[model samples]
Structures are given as structure tokens and as C-alpha cells.
Target: MINVVGFRYCRLGTADLEETVKFGTDMIGLETVGRENGSVYMRGDDRDHNICYFEGDPTDHTLGLELADFDALDAAESTLTTAGLDVHRGTGEEATARRCMGYINFKDPSGNSIDLTVRPFAAGRRYFPGRDAGIDEFSHIGLRVTDPREAEKFWSEVFNFKTSDWIGWSALMTFDEVHHRFALFPSDRPGIQHINFQVSETDDVMRSNYFLRDHQVRIQAGPGRHSLSGARFLYFYGPDEMIYEYSCGVRMVDDTWRARQFPVNDASFCAWGSKPDLSVLEGPDAAE
Candidate 1:
């Protein structure tokens, strides 16, 4: 059931890829659309690129997802090699270094890194930031999971995500309808625990919270307001320490939405009362 559909790009691994592509374009506004082999390509919207840095192991990560052609990428690599996992299939120069026309790769029981592509590559216009901060797109993410209920039951049974709420054991997943594109977080190891991007309101999340405090950066919380996707966030800290967000209004669900449950404190992670250190969703190795 690996139907995913789209949420492409994120191939990070940076121990100074030109100082994280100049801190993702002069401090997280992202735009630089291309660099080759050693990788770089950025963008906040207008697809074709969403994050690629490279060079290597700053806790290397990868997350591209999208599948609908090439027979749903050969039926999601034969349903993740018949469910035992260990898929691979991406060649052709690793699908031209993942600008994608095909892809596979795997690792999910909390090891993060998944790719799944098929036909991905779109931007023929729009997107030109490099420093707008009011940029909008490249939305959800915050994965890291040692075992948030076996990574939300292996992404709700091998990939069509789902859950849309829950705070203690984390969760907030999604397949579509925005409410979340994944929020898991219960780390011990495993990467990406933040990297959202939607911004175009709440004054671009309080003008990037004083433009990341006059460029000293390191904010790590909100401009406030998100009791479950009501968005309007801020969270900072970039480059190798990762974690960069800049939300705005988010809240869209369908199928009559439902999922709830909010307990792990701080007004369920902010509701205009910011207090960031969620202890990384208090996973504590989630029952190691």
C-alpha cells in the first residue's frame, strides 16, 4: 500500500557543503536551484528541488516520497521487498542523482531514509526566494522515531500514513489534506525531527520572529500558536543542527477528520504559550 503520491525531496548530509549552501541561501529562505555532483539544489517552492545539500554524514538523512508512475514505482518495489524491507532499485546514476524519474531506497522501522520517487521534477516557473522568508511550501516533517508505536505502525501499515493527532506517543501523520505530513518524533537515533516551511502569514510567523533574532538564529520554538496544526510557528536552528520551521495557518483535514488526544504538556505543544523543549517528544527511547 505504498501509495504516497508526493512530498518529494530532502537529501541532507552536510558537514559543510559550502556551509550548508550558505545556510540554505543566506539563512533559510532557500532558492539556489542547482549545483551538481557533490549536490546542493535548494528551493522553498516551485518543486524540482526542495533540499539537497550533500558532502556527507552530519547524521545523513533522506526522505523524498512520491509514487504514481512507472507502475507506482514497480508497485513500491514489490511492496518493500514483500515486507521484509531492504529495497533498493535506484540506479541510472541513482536516478540522475535523484532529480528522479525513478527511485526506491528504504529504511523505515525508525531508521528514517526513504525515497520512493517516480517522475518527480516539476518547477518550470515560480520560486525565487533566497531570502524572502515569507516563502510558502515545502511543508511537513519531524520524523525521528525509535518507535513511536513502531513508527506509527510502520507508517500506518507500509505507507499511506494516516493518524492526525496524538501528543504523548507523538503521531500527527497524514497522506494528504495537510493537517500533517508526519510529526512522529520519539528519537533515540534516526534523523530529521524538524523542517517544515509553509510561510505567508501571521506576518510570516512574526516576520521570521524578528528575522531569527537579527540573524543570531537559534530560536527553536514558536512565534506561538499550534495546538495541533493551527500553525503560526517559528522554530529555528539550521545548518548541521537542522530543525527549521516557519509555519502559518495550517489546518486541513478530510474524511471527516477525527484523531485527537493531546497530553504531553505545554498546552499540547503550544497554543500561544511557547515552551519549545518538548524533550524531543519525550521519547526516552520509546520502550527501547
Candidate 2:
């Protein structure tokens, strides 16, 4: 097993870096920390950065995960190679670009880029948001996969991710279990489906619901509670139609948690009956 130790950061390519960075600060309430080489670093909580946006194709996305140390990273590279996936050991300059001590990058079975790193940098200063959105930390993400079953098996077997729950074939998986680190959503293409930040309370979720609406940002779904994780959430579309979420009061599990399956439907997605296009969550197989 790869033994993932942290769900750290995302490197996303945006069509216009300036616009995306402005939207992130003015609308979504992220703090801009630094900029270099056309990449803008941002964070919701105090780590070096949580997401980096660069000017490039909007479809390009990479998720960064932390390993225990260089030994674990070495083991991960060997494991991925033995499994027949090509792995690139990151150069020192590339590791500096990723804000890590050492790293390797590879594509998952579904072609989503993943960076496994050791000694990711942390900030000495605390985070201060551009807006008081009550953001607590950068949390989970939704990863798009071509096949849910295959993706589930690959993550659960090849790495330490374990399923916390499922809506249809899609799995809410975690390594350290703050509910889920990756919410696997089946799609025709591979990329990050959504980025999530945990806010302080339900009021944060509801407040952002109106705040985003007044700002002319498109509301994607929810000021509703999720049935699976028991968190109140608000999702909105930012630049390039990328989804960002703020949620609070998520359930946490230990070894005692039992994974349960829920059919793809309105209640499975939300407890308060706010209908998001359920097809977006379940993908092409929703109507089958």
C-alpha cells in the first residue's frame, strides 16, 4: 500500500490566472500567499498553500498527497512502477515548484494526475481570508473517473484509501478518515470534479449561499445537508465552470465505521431536498 498520510493540495490550470485568482479571493474567500512563474498560490488555512492556479488549459488538474517520508515516496514509486504505471521522480527544482522536499508524479488508473510528496512546506504565519467565509481548512475533493468500480478497486487496493460510503458505484474514500478525502465521481473524462473547503459552522454554509447569489456567482447546489457525511454545504461555480464547495460539521469515522450503499437519488445526495442535477454526481449511469 502507498500509505497516504495527507490530502494536501491541488495544482489547477486556468484559462486566465488573474481572473481565477481574483474570483478565488473576492468570491470564494481564499487567501493569496505568493506568486512565481505565472502560478498564484492560495490557501484557506495555514499551510504553505492549498491550491495553485496557473495559466494553461482549464482541464489540467493535479492532486497532491503526502507520504510519510522519502522512504515511503520511494516505496510508492516502486509500487506504481511494478503495477505498470509510469512514474516520474520529480527534480529538485520541480519539488521546489510543488512546495515539497521530494516528490513523484503519476497518473492513476483513470488518468488523473497525482503527486506524492514528502515534507510539504507549512506556513509560519496564520491564514487570513480575503473575505470572512468562515473557512477552516482545505478539505476533500471530488475526483472524476472513467469507471467507478475500477477506480474504487485501484484506490482501495493500491493505496490506503478505504470506502466510507457509496452513492451507486461511486465511493467516498479516505486514508485517515475525516469522512472522505476523495469522493470518486464517475465521468467520461478524468479531472477534479470539485474542490472543497471546510467552514466553521452551518451559518457559514447558509451565509455563503446568499453571498454567492448576490455576487452573481452561479449556485451549483445546496444550502442543504448531505445525508452521507452529515455536513451542511454550499457549492458554486467559479471560473472555467469549476466547482468549489464550503461545508461544515462533517462526520468523522474511525475503524468502527461501516460502509453503506445508497441508490442514486435526491435523498442520497441531500437530506433537505435541494436538487442538484443528480446526474452530475452519478454521471452517465444515473439513468440506467
Candidate 3:
């Protein structure tokens, strides 16, 4: 099994780089850290960067995972190759672009781009947001998968990601103590379903609701508590049709915690009587 440590960063392609930058800074409250070539780097915490928007096709997306060290990264590459998966080592220029010492790129079973990186850089200074969304950290991500059962097995067997809970075909998984760092939702296509950032408290969720509404950013879902993770959340749309989430009060699990399963339904998603925009969860069909 690959000893995956945690999620590092996400790289997304945008048609309008400046518009995405503005949405990230002015709407999502991320701090713009660097802009070079055709890419804009933004941060939500001490990490050198948590998100990068580069000029390319909007369909391009890459999720990065940090390994323990060079040895661990090497082990991961060997493991993936042995398992009959194609792994590509990042070039020196590519490593420099990602702000990492080394990295290897591959695709998950669901076809989402995965970058296993070594020595991802962190900022020396604290993060300052353009707006006060009270973001604490870039928390987790929701990945759309064609077959959740097979996807869940792949993640568990390959990377040893533990299942924390399951709502229908959606599997909530964790790499460490935090309840879930990755989730797989059933869909016909493969892509990021949503990117989540944890806020300081429920007040932050409420504030962002009004703040996003005032700015006329389309509110897709939330301002409700999730039954699965016990987090209060708000979901909204951003540039390139990407979904962004602000959540707080997520429950944590440890070695003693047992994984639970729930039937896929509205109640399993939200306990506070707020229906999430189903299109965001299941893809575009529910919306129509």
C-alpha cells in the first residue's frame, strides 16, 4: 500500500485566469500569493499555495498528495507501477512550477489526476484573506466516480484510505485523524464534485451566506448541517463551473471510531431540512 500522508494542493485549468483569480480572492477569500507565466497561486493557510488556476482547458484538474519523504515518494511510484498503473515522474521544471522538491503524476481508478509530491513548500508568514470568510484550512474534496464500489476499493486497497461513512454510493474516506479528507460520489463523469474549506465556526458559515448573497454569487446549497460529518456548510459556484464549499464543525474520528453506512437520500445528506442543489452532488442531470 502507498503510505499517503495528506492532501497538499489542487491545480485547475481555467479559460479566464484573471476571472478565476478574482473569484478566488474577492469571493472565496483566498489570499493571492503568486502570479507567474499563466498561473495564479492562492493560499488559505500557511501552505505555499492551496489552489492554482492556470490558463488551459477548464476540464483539466490535478489533485496533489504529500508523502512523508523522498523514500516514501519512491515507494509510491514503485507500488503504482507494480500494480500496472502508469506513473510519470515530474521534471525539474515541473517540480519548480508546483513548488515541490519532487512529484509523480498518475490517474486514480476514477481517472482524476493524482500528483504524489515530496516536500511541498509552506509559507513563512501567516495567511491574510482578501475577505473575512474565516477560513481555517483547505479541508477536503468530493470526487465524482462512475462506480463508487470499485472506486472505494481502489482507494482503500491502494492508498489505505479508511472509510469513515457511506451515504448510498458516496464513500467518506480519511487518510488521517480528520473524519474524511476525500469523498467519492456516484456520477457518470469523472471530475471534482466540490472543493471544501473549513471555516472557524458556524458564525463563519452564516456570515459567508450573507456575504456571498450580497455579492450575487450563486448559492448552490447549504447553510445547513450535514448528517454525515456533522458540519455546517454552504456550497456555491465559482469560475469554470467549479463548486466551492465553506464548512465548519466537522466531526473527528480516531482509531476507536467505527465506520457507518447510510442509505443515499436527502436525510443522509442534511439533517437540518435544507436540500442541497442535487446537481452539485449528482452532476447536471438532477438540475434538469
User: Which candidate leads the pack in TM-score?
Assistant: 2
Candidate 1 lDDT, 189-215, residue by residue in tens: 888878888988898788779977898
- In candidate 2 the C-alpha lDDT for residue 8 amounts to 91
TM-score of 3: 0.96
Reference-based lDDT, residue 162, model 2: 94
Winner of 1 and 2 under TM-score: 2
lDDT of 3: 0.88
Ranking by lDDT: 2, 3, 1
Whole-model lDDT per candidate: 0.85, 0.93, 0.88
Residues 157-272 of candidate 3: C-alpha lDDT, one tens digit per residue? 99979999987667899989888998887777777878999999999999999999999999888789989899999999998889899999999999888989886567878999
The stretch of ten residues in a row with the least summed lDDT in candidate 1 is 279-288
lDDT of 2 by residue, 77-165 (tens): 99999999999999999999999999999999889999999999999999999899999999999999988888989999999999999
lDDT of 1: 0.85
Model 3 sits at a Cα RMSD from the real structure of: 2.6
Residue 121, model 3: lDDT of 89
